[model samples]
Target: MDLSNIDLSKFDGLAFIWLDIETITGTGVYDTLSSPDTWFVHKNPDVCEDFICSDLKNKQIFLITSGSLGHKIIKSIHHLPQLHSVYIYCQDIARHTPLASEFKKIRSVCNKTQSLISQLAIDVAHICVNIGDQHSRLNKHKQALVWYERAFEKIKQHNGLTKNEFVNALKSKINISTLECQRFQQHRQQLGEGMNEVKYQHELLRQLLDVPTPLSSTEKDDKHIAATIKKIDEWERKNIQQIKTVAERVRQQLQKQINEINKVNKVKHDFRLINDELRQRQSEDDYVEADLQQWLERLQQLKHQLETTTISDTSQIDVQITDDIDWSSMVKLVESDVSKTWVRTREISMVESL
Candidate 1:
């Protein structure tokens, strides 16, 4: 129920006002109220600072609204001396808002409904944001912010951060991640040689943001990976060059072998020609040798025949002529001439025998 509808007489010695502070520009939850004694008020705030500077003491207020609470409302509420504890309840956004240091001392409830259940939801988120913000200031490695997310997740609808207030939430998340990123960096150094720095950085970054290993974290991460890639590229280039070199050498060797084979074949062809010429010459020499043998045999036979005929015929004629000498015939005929001829013949035959 709204404060205006409630009975004021029953709440003795206390004042009450209805402040429609929510969604109003330059208006505050505390700036609208002006009460002298212990009071309870609800009213929409003025558009200027006239309401915030007004004097009032011993007040009790219930600031109720929906939608985003502006800086004017939140800031002015911190200045109220009479308002020891304030509960600014929202029926629009949930789980995302930039809270102040006073939030640690006071209470707040932001919800999407006008029921007790919504109130309880607001209370839960308030407590979590308060506690998480405390630990975040101490740089608690995002462990403390676990409570903040868990609180919202319990009653979350239409996305965990709640779509209406997600812009602020996104901002908050970035802030949280940035802090954790810094924390992980410091952690990697302390981790020393025992911890694999690459693994450590990667794991921490995983928690902070769902992204690839970034180059901004440390020089080692980028340099080491970059250097390895460089080496691999170099190796590939060298491998191609090496293969080309080996192929060239093999080609040269094959060409040399082909030249040697051609030279040997030419030599073999020349030898075949020489063999053919020798064979032809040998045949000519054989024919010449046979002709010489025939001539030598004919000469020997002719010489033997001539000697036999001259010796045998001359001897027979000598035998036929008697030694008897007739004086008349010897005077008439020339027997002395025949004896001279016979003596010449005998001298020739003796020379032939010697």
Candidate 2:
């Protein structure tokens, strides 16, 4: 795909492309098509190939091509997932039928323009139905609903569809929309219940704010308390050592950057000569306005050099620390009986589900 030609702002979900040597501007085909949002016509086979390949966003492509060029383009692009269907438009349907039969993407070979238009409309509706079914199978409810709506609209526009087909498509769209609304209502109710539960929990925690003597004097309790403190102390010491090592490494890097800065200072030393010359000229009253302007230009050049100067092998370093702790598991420790030996918490629910 030639990604440079794509404008994401003008993205389309579907494209109708006609590839023929004849110009489509004056032809009735372009005007007959219902959706012109992403319609395209190409006289050159190479340009058609480029357009088909450039739609990398997986937009469905319905291609109408002359029989002479159909075989060439189909062989190259028929396997593409986005090339949904192809139709052969030529004077001799018999000649192209044998060729079209070889490819599964070819819907039909038609000689009459009216027949081609009717078939195209029918295929478009069916395409929407198939796409909607695929999305439904994948559990993409919102996307499925969108496709179903598209299908229903297409069916309504074409009278060739059977009464049952039109009614069924409408029902599918309505059912999906109804189910989506029910899901949203359930989600809102769940959120409300969760909020109430959180409020209740906070009230219970607040009641214990002034309470005391919760733990009885027992050796088991003392041991557990000491063990928890010991665990925290070990964590503190380990993290402190890690931080100190990281600090020392950063200090070494800073020293190297300072060395680079010293090199820049050496370059600044060369500018001192110009400064001295300017001072000498001023003191001796030997400088004209032009001389002052010349000296000012040199100073500007020196300023530009300093501002644009970059130090090699010196970039800002960032420190990243990873912490993996099950905070919920820690809460279990306070609730556990200290009389029994401490058992490390295991996230068995997640493992069992997996």
Candidate 3:
């Protein structure tokens, strides 16, 4: 197949390529991704490599491949600067995880098709955010603003992103805009049109900052804390219900065992009555071969019952208690590196264990 027919440069934003040993269809992977910006290449690692080298040399590439093909081609293509990220799609995630660990560009090893699609969307958004971060660090305010806007737009489009992720993306966009506004202020005296640009940026920032409502910082914090407490309360209720269910089951089992022991005790109580009958028969001089035989048989039966009825040991039943969750960590929200957007950032009051 001629790779030259497909013009990746025609696309304004990102480009993705899927390389597998066979054509992938009906997996909804193609449908989930933007089809116009994507290409499917099968069974030709050499051609795929050449296509990236010759045609996609200038453009950044996001590649997805089967575990076997990825293992075969990763060593050859991993060094390419155009290869931004690689996703390994396979039936066995554990089998491919070690291979992914070897390459930083290998973002995730996804066994489920939906997981791959979701991760692709997230990685694309994060790439944009990271690109914006790079431009910001280099003091290129205008370029940084464009990438940040792209990131925010992508975040909004992809529903896979959590509330905190969306908010962080917005914050990054706002931060870059603030920097650009400050830069515009410094040059407003020299440039005649700088004042107009400043006004526009300020207005944009105002709209971006208008999150939900016009609440004060303290008010927002209080609202968030209340919501966190509510979530904790819900968790506590669920765990308590589970504990109650387990305790009831254990209590019922113990009762059943106790009932079996009570039956054995009743048989032992009947032994005294049999002895009284034997004593009465002997005192009354009721001596016969058949009577003696019957008495002996009755005594043997009672003795056998006592010897065969074995009670289960209660010590074997045990309750295991493990406290593995750190609930307090949820209250403290620490801001970390947002550039690694693929890594799900821990938010305040997130009970990840649950």
Candidate 4:
């Protein structure tokens, strides 16, 4: 029987069997009828019945089939695979069917979807790190740290593996984060130390400014003050270079510390994210890591500058107050009875004397 072109839909509620036979008889005829109609004869009806029963049992062995003939003709069919679950089928009357192509497509789609999800997770980590770095630049240390920790946590989360793998990955991330945090703290301590040194230098400058000039016994105090001011000018000129050196060192140290902390944090964060992407089977881009390394090199240069700067003390000032006044006249005026009477007769003086 040529059944390839047959529309199974036409057989609705009827049971039929198709058979092809190559016989070497004079003609393919039986019971004085054509070959096609011969299988319906009473004596050969079992031949048709047996083929129908065997094929139907084999096809219905599972829960269902979607072939149009099954839907139209089946009344109480049992053990058929659901039609929706049957994606593809290729059957041979004499051999077992294989489903290589269908499963391949399913696996490909699943993998692609997983890759997309992992990529999205990595991108989020990148944005968080960038924002954190920016905040650090603005001197918002607490906010920056918060964002950085969040980025680190997100990357760690993406290490989406089973318990054993997750535990190992989490331990690694914790170690790295701890090290990075400590390094930043050290930099901050250095910056604070440099600021303290600058403050010490400033206090020294204040002391120099406060120093009094030696006064002659007969010179007015104003003359002594003027002489001291002149000495202070000379000291300022001599010490200006040293003060500038100290100020520069402090500025460079602060900048270096800030840059170092930022660079180290960025490297730790990027490394974590890269590791996570690899584990999750996502793409890795090295641009961010390269930028962080560049920042580290720049900070190193600043540190060098800070280390090389030198501070020197300013030269001391010298001044002379002349002793040219008449001491006798001043002393007589101070001891005169008119001056003494005015001193004793004033109300303010009486209050002080009482």
Best by TM-score: 2
**Cα lDDT over the full model 2:** 0.69
Go through the candidates in order and give each one's C-alpha lDDT.
0.45, 0.69, 0.71, 0.39
Query: Which candidate, 2 or 4, has the higher lDDT?
Result: 2
Could you give the candidate ranking by lDDT, starting with the highest?
A: 3, 2, 1, 4
Residue range 1-354, candidate 1, lDDT tens digits: 111221222322222332444434432322322222222233445432234335333333333433243333656665554333334455443442445233532344544333423443344444445445555666764644564564455336312345557335634754675678677878767886547777888887675543233344356446655765665566557767976997788778656655655555555565566556557766776447765565556555554544443222222332133556443432221112213221221111100100
- Candidate 4 has its poorest 10 consecutive residues by lDDT at 345-354
| TM-score, predicted candidate 2 vs. hidden true structure | 0.46
Candidate 3, superposed: residue stretches over 4 Å from native:
1-14, 26-42, 137-139, 165-170, 178-354
**What TM-scores do the predictions have?**
0.22, 0.46, 0.43, 0.21
lDDT of 4: 0.39
Task: Look at candidate 3 and give me any clashing residue pairs.
Answer: 330-349
Overlapping backbone residue pairs in candidate 2 total 0
Please give the distance, in angstroms, between residue 296's alpha carbon in candidate 1 and its true position after superposition.
99
By summed lDDT, the worst window of 10 consecutive residues in model 1 runs over 345-354
Alpha-carbon shift of residue 129 in model 1 (angstroms): 1.0
lDDT of 4 by residue, 208-234 (tens): 445343643235445645765665555
